[model samples]
Target chain A: MYSPACKVTDIASLIPQRSPIMMVDDYIIEDELNCRSELAVGADNMFLDETGRLSVEGVLEHIAQTAAAHIGYLHRQAGETVTLGYIGDIKRCAVTGPLPAVGTTLHTHVTVISQVGDVSLVSAETSAENNPILNCRMKVAEG
Target chain B: MEKDELVKKMIEILADEFEVEPEVIQPEANIKETMHLDSLSLVDMVGLVNEEFGVEIKTPDLPTIKTFADLYDYVFTRM
Candidate 1:
């Protein structure tokens, strides 16, 4: 069984990313096909632009990392190494609101739309509170 | 799936995703070279296989695949 709440320190082992660059704080696998993750946006986040707002690319990465975390959690459960995964492509990405500010909690939800041979196409959306922030379809590849 | 049927299905997927005629893809045709597959299209191919066949292809293994026949054999063995 997997815990719903994960410690921030354990995020690193689930994903290949490290601090400052790692956007997700913790995550939960809701089921076999869906996962949810959250990040406490801070001034130290590397994706902040000159305006101190998270860039569009940052939002995409946030969603991608959440998906990665889900995959990682499964790998760990199977007693396998968490393999490296890459964002093969991003499509239909729409930023609907102002970039979230520091101190805001970003909640990301990812659903596996399809998966074939180490490649998965996922639909992801991010929100702050009930307000929608971004949505997109992403292709993830395992390496 | 039979070998011939599998090859046909893979070819159809490749043709549809790449926007090429199915007749263009031969068993020995180099997919990347003949289809002019860009990096993004290559990723789409991976996603297609995963969704259609329940396979999980890794990027490192891509280098080993040069022809449609090679891809077919790979997926066939795994299945």
Candidate 2:
């Protein structure tokens, strides 16, 4: 069983993320409820140009990674280390342009929706700076 | 409205989108669990759902479905 919630900032101590892959900037928790957080997009990846332009797929990946950030936090609170897990499934992928930012600060929100076996399903939505960007269903597990 | 007919349609659509054969998928088969469909394949599966069923789904909802029965239920419910 996993702990109720943990601060996103505290999770970095438990998970391994270097530069570009470390998208989540920080996390916020209040009264044991995990709420808003921010994620930063690196200008260095090929998927994202210095111009801040990116492919729809790139936008989708960033959103997916942000969802992973929440799972990482939950794992740490559970007294377990983050483990390897695939992206699992992405259903409706809709994107308009490169994520509009030379660098983006995305505010991410995740809510528990369903659970199957050991996997916990969460629904996520994010906005970069101030614009709504993407919505995704996420699944997390530990091996 | 027929489950068998819908399954046949699903088989044809899956084969065409995933570039396999209709016979390759059986009622007992699971798309991701048995067919070895990765994330990219799941994206294509959504496209197939859009084309075949005219239902719009987010990429995340696809993974929530664990079995053929779940998917069939989802599609039928939408229609």
Docking class of 1: incorrect
RMSD for each model, in Å, please? 5.2, 7.8
Q: Pick the candidate with the highest lDDT.
A: 1
The segments of candidate 2 whose C-alpha lies over 4 angstroms from its true place after superposition are: A1-7, A30-34, A96-98, B1-79
Stretch of 10 with least lDDT, candidate 1 chain B: B38-47
lDDT per residue for candidate 2 within B1-79, as digits (tens), equals: 6867787788777776676766767655677855677644555566467657876555467676777777877787786
lDDT of 2: 0.60
Per-residue alpha-carbon lDDT of model 1 for A31-120, expressed as tens digits? Answer: 778888888889988888998888888888899899888888888888999989999888878888878888888988898876656767
Where is model 1 chain A poorest over a 10-residue stretch in terms of lDDT? Answer: A1-10
